[model samples]
Target chain A: MSANVKQKRTLLEWVRGYTGQKYITTVLFLLIPIVLLTLFTLIPAVNMVIFSFQERDQLGVNPKWIGLDNYVTLFTDPTYLSTFKNCIYYFFGSFIQLALALLIATILCSKIKFGNLFKGILFFPYMMNGVAVSLIFRRFFQKGDGITNSEGTLNTILALFGLDPVKWLSTPGLVNVCLVFASIWRYIGFDIIMFIGAIQSISPDVYEAADLDGANGWQRFWYIVFPSIRSIVALQLVLAIKGAASVFEIPYIITGGRNDTSTFVIKTIDTAFVYKKVGLGSAMAIVLLLIILIITGIQKLCFRERK
Target chain B: MAENKHYFDLKDYTFKETPKSVRILFQVLKYAFLVVCCLVVIIPLIIVLFGSLKTHDEYIQSNVFALPAVPQFSNYVTAFNQGNVLRGLFNTMIILVISCFGTIITGTMTAFVVQRFNMMFTKVVKAIFLIVALLPSISMQVTVFQIVNKLGLYDNMAAPIIMYIGTDIIAIQIFIQFLDNISVSLDESAILDGCSYPRVYWSIILPMLRPAIATVLVIKFVGIYNDFYTAQLYMPSPKNAVVSTALYTFVGPYGAKWEIIFAGIIICIIPTLVIFLALQKSIYSNLVSGSVKE
Candidate 1:
């Protein structure tokens, strides 16, 4: 007992001595996570940029220095060009997503009963796993056997309306649309929650003043609500663009990058693992990163100018 | 006869409100839109749930809207055994606990030091994190995979746990914001009372950071649970597979068998759904505050 007490005293004394050097202790605390972050995140990111320039195998072995050839091929390749076009579809989908979310959020923000229930139900899908969502939507969009066969929920609904079953996944042109719809279904709730928060943050005095001015609902929303949520809207726009560019899970799982739904990230993964062209894949990823950076920069500038 | 007195109407005296008919119309429209949105969100999920209860022949024979003649409760049993869900759940729980605690400790510690100290190096570190947050992480996966392999972390459960704990910039940001709000005088008082810096962190600061810690814990837990891509890439072996990757077996082995796949998805989602429903208020509010405060 005496030895244990003495040992504890000495440990306390040592800790006291250590704490006397406050700055050093502070540095020590910060050092650990920072080093881990550098090792796992920062260095790997820098290595990605470096790998973009070096020709390497999928396993990252036998590197040969190849300059801008990967970038050149990436830009000129027909398949990759189509992927960029598909990104535009997702970009448009993001706009629709934002608009729809904004509408729902606005309505929910108004005086209504069961608002919480509505919000909860709407936001449920955002909690779902990407793989699970893909599976659910895959089953939902399955084509029926005959005009009366109920192969999928969608086909059942279509048959009820006396319409032919839509080839949601199989058709080249329709596949991207279906994937975009699924993305919207999964992600729109997040935007709604964000918009609701932003809308709620705006002081009610502004709305009351607008009401005193005899403003209609549409006019009030246009002049008051829209301006209040502009920053969030801008942020979501950038995020949407980023999401559209790097979309992977839905198309990758549903169609395995088939039927014109291949995204840039999907293509990058294919190039790296499937084709064993790590160098080219790294270049493609870098290009996508640069594109995102440029787009985000432009958005910042636009928002800044407006301010 | 005394003149009859006319009472002043409060409604007329006040500012003109929306017409009652228009208000009713708006209410009707609002409910209609909300119902449609709810259906859009839930109809697919409901179909999946019902589909899971049906057998293969029944699924093909009946419309998706049709209720199963006899619910196949055994599908869940088969899915649990064949899909390796039990093992996956165990592995995922282990990873989630380790990574969640790791994230919280590191995030709070870093935030505490950065907020308490006014050093050039700390500022640089903060700037590095900010820049990293702006960059797209998925784009760097190729090199990350290489780094993981070089470190011999590939196919190890530790790889995802390490990556998750180290790569969470949002948690650090949230913690720093919370720490900034906490007055520095508390730390000074603890120090003056002969408490060591680490002791001050443990006794004074950490207890005060309960809300922030809860927010970060929920967000990180859900994000890690739903993540399939990282787990699939780093921990591909069956023994090391987490929940998301383990669920992938259904897709691969039970291809085109929507009934079993639905069952597997339900099994995967049940825990998260229950948690979300139970903590809906805290989770939703935290998510809102975390995003909106930025």
Candidate 2:
């Protein structure tokens, strides 16, 4: 109790030390955002959960208590269910992408030639903002453009050896796949950069010790490099899961959830903004939030400190 | 068998004079893989450039990945004149500058109190702001729109800018981490020298916050300026539209003016994109330093 009073007095002394208009600075500093966020962000966020518990009538004015019926409907809703499957597709496939990203990071961080130049180019897609990536990819995906035709970039070149011309973003299954691939391409370089830093953090003495023990490259990597960067890989895994959940921009831009390719985010936006079904949208949002919470919990369990 | 390779890489142990066949194969594979990755990333950008130069029909029928036949530069002029992309550019600039300024002032001030001052209220405030990063805005979609309408800030430049500053909690959280490392000595010195708390921040602390300041400005400028969602959702009117929205409409019913849309995209990307490319080094360097410090 005496200590509390003593700390308070010193704080007051500091305050009193300021010459003119005491406490005015504190007031000014905290004013704008405090006021704005209180009303704009906090209130609305609270209201969103409340709205989800109610049902609105046709005229868009009347809202009645629904008692979790909307969540029940969302679970049974075919479109929503389909979206979960698609997101699962995106999530698993992206792990394969992380391996590619790790490979790139390894090479870039290695004593190989022109590694900096390679790193810069690999990171190029990531630096350009999301909007450009969307628009440019939209052009790239246009069917008539034939750029995506059998002799087009993917068709005539990379996958040219056999498989059919993947409609890219045109078909429902392929659309989700294509969007996931694009998302991977766009953002995986960031993981590469992060991984390079993690790899660099491993002490040279450890590797030297491994070399002195006559450990081969694979053995050294398994014993040293992999273990050292587990924290980073854990971080990347969390990021990847979050990416799967909140991947709104790509789906929104490319298909706008067209031909049943929409994710939960797209459905929520449509319900709220377009259909004037704010209550339904709120319910969907809550469902998504719950799912994410579960996922986050599981991720924490999976990536917990294993030392 | 071992007396061959001469080169020592960044890891810095010397090798023999000549490389082995297996080493040569791995090097070849590494460069080839990197080249392919670079091309895939760069192709979208290349296509955007080429697509911008073609006629609308040409963009449709011909190869999007192909070089333009005539290299029509008129698409840009047409896009600027027809789309009111110029107006969109001007409107976005206003929001970008004002919102960034508002964000900095509010964020720095809020963060300062939240981090430095020991009030009970500030603790609650910090907790709320910390969680703000987790709460996705898309979850609050309907309420935000309704609230904006209630506030009478709907569809105006004020709407997007307000949202920008209002949701700017996480960046400030990051800023506070940096501010934590910064010594409070100058603030104390200024206070003792008869400066008020605000005055001390203005004169003493804000100057010392140059690294943090640069990091914030460059990062925020690129992010908010390049944002599509907030602008797409809130400010839908062409008169009040940002470049992203303008480009969206340009591809719509009255005009799928592909050439113009393409041109507008190029124009829209220029200011922030050029700044991005030029300051790429500095921005990455600052981010590296900040990330390292954190």
lDDT of 2 at B17: 33
Per prediction, fnat is: 0.53, 0.44
In model 1, the Cα lDDT at residue A121 comes to: 93
Against the true structure, candidate 1 reaches a TM-score of 0.91
Q: Report the C-alpha lDDT of model 2 over B56-170, residue by residue, as the tens digit.
A: 6676666556778899988999878877788878887899899889888788878776777766767888888876666667767567887888778778888888888888765
Candidate 2 Cα misplacement greater than 4 A, ranges: A1-25, A57-60, A145-166, A201-220, A295-307, B1-19, B56-61, B185-195, B254-257, B287-294
Error of 1 at A93 (Å): 0.8
Candidate 2 local lDDT, residue A2? 100
Give me the runs in candidate 1 sitting further than 4 Å from their true place: A1-20, A146-150, A302-307, B1-22
What is the C-alpha lDDT profile of model 1 across A116-148, one tens digit per residue?
999999998898888889888888888876432
Candidate 1 yields a Cα-based lDDT of: 0.82
Best candidate per lDDT, number? Answer: 1
Residue-pair clashes per prediction, in order, are 0, 7
